[model samples]
Target: MNNRFKAVLFGVLLVYGLMLSASFILALFVRFDWISTQSLDWLPFLISLTIMLLGGGLSGFRSSEKGWLSGVLVGVIYTVMIMLYQFLAHDVWLHDGQWLHFITFLLASISGGIIGVQLNQRND
Candidate 1:
């Protein structure tokens, strides 16, 4: 209910929403045969970065100095959600596609954390 908590929640929700959208769009493209669905994991990576930006921007707007943690937290949440969704939809684990999400999430978290930290310090 406080500003800090609100900002963190907002960032996580924003990233999760964007990541879901990206996954859905990727599914569409794959279904249409426009692109190889096998590479759909790329969607999460790119979208995660976008979400990181959103998270960083929100944290910056809130004038909070907790950018890196917020970004990393958001990334981790998004990754967990994505993995859950994948499991529910495919009912499978240990697939190539699954690994993509895992790897991308890891990278996104690091990059997003750094970005968030930098952004938090920008106006200081």
Candidate 2:
């Protein structure tokens, strides 16, 4: 595979790993009563932002052109992967308001890609 593809894959994996780690830590905290679910309701959004930003940035860094497009592709891939997993594992379907979150993820990713491309240009 090309370097850009490899970078996007790496970014996705990195995001997934970080998310898994975060989930484990959150579970531990909840089990120990160190945190409550109600208070941490925003965690998912935060995690999603991080995932898109990191993934998009990596993609943009490696992409030869159209960094925003690359970022959008990465975001879409990640969203589809997560949705598919949820469907397969829990039979869950997309509910109301979820689309907004998805849009936010896409926008965040695009912004990250822009920044990454600019940074790469600067470095060169």
Candidate 3:
């Protein structure tokens, strides 16, 4: 409801839109034989990391303090949303193998938040 939370949500939505666009493009490429599907096996993980990083950065920029905490919260929320969607759509659940992806996302988001806070401070 607050400005910071709103910014985080906006960032998440923005990333999701970008991901959807990318997926569509990839699908087209695959359909046309321009790229092999096997090459895109890592796309989902990369997209997830990117989304969390951008979302956390936005949150940190808008928040008054506790940038790391804000980043962590954003990362967790994003992951949960993604997992829930996957579960509902594909009946998939998290497995032990996915822990690395989650950790990577969290770390990337925290790093982004730190950068955002630093940038905001510099601009002030």
Candidate 4:
């Protein structure tokens, strides 16, 4: 397999893994009344930003060049996966504010990818 492809694959997987773990933990917290659901309204946004950034960073680190491209690929793939999931599971074709979220997430990932490249360069 190509190194770049491996990088993107791992990045996506890492994001999904983190999301699963986070969901489980949050579910536990909610189930046990450790946190109020009302107060966790920002949870999705936070998680999306954080996970995408991490994934983009990983992709950039592994690719070792063209960080922005890596970030864009990761963001697009992630968004497509999400759309597929919603369509298959919930029978939903579209959602409000999708573009806003996509743009924000993409920018966050791009920023992270650039940072990751800088870090890699510094280490080299």
TM-scores for candidates 1 onward, in order:
0.59, 0.88, 0.81, 0.94
For model 3, state the Cα shift of residue 51 in Å: 3.5
lDDT, ranked from best to worst: 4, 2, 3, 1
Q: How far is candidate 1 from the true structure (C-alpha RMSD, Å)?
A: 3.9
Best by TM-score: 4
- Whole-model Cα lDDT of every candidate shown, in order: 0.63, 0.80, 0.76, 0.86
Q: lDDT per residue, candidate 1, 4-110, as tens digits?
A: 56766776667667767877887788889998857765555566566666754564355365555655566666667767876898886466666765665655554
What is the TM-score (0 to 1) of candidate 1? Answer: 0.59
Each prediction's RMSD over C-alphas, in Å, is 3.9, 1.6, 2.1, 1.1
Steric collisions counted per model: 0, 0, 0, 0
Tens digit of lDDT per residue, candidate 3, span 75-119? 777678879988999898887877778788888878777777777
Residue 103 in candidate 2 has what lDDT?
Answer: 88
- Where does candidate 1 stray beyond 4 Å? 38-44, 60-63, 79-107, 110-124
Residue pairs clashing, model 3: none
**lDDT (10s digit) by residue, model 4, range 10-113:** 88888889888989999999999999899898887899899999999998888888888888888888888888998999999778988789888888788767
Q: Looking at model 4, which ten-residue stretch has the lowest summed lDDT? A: 108-117
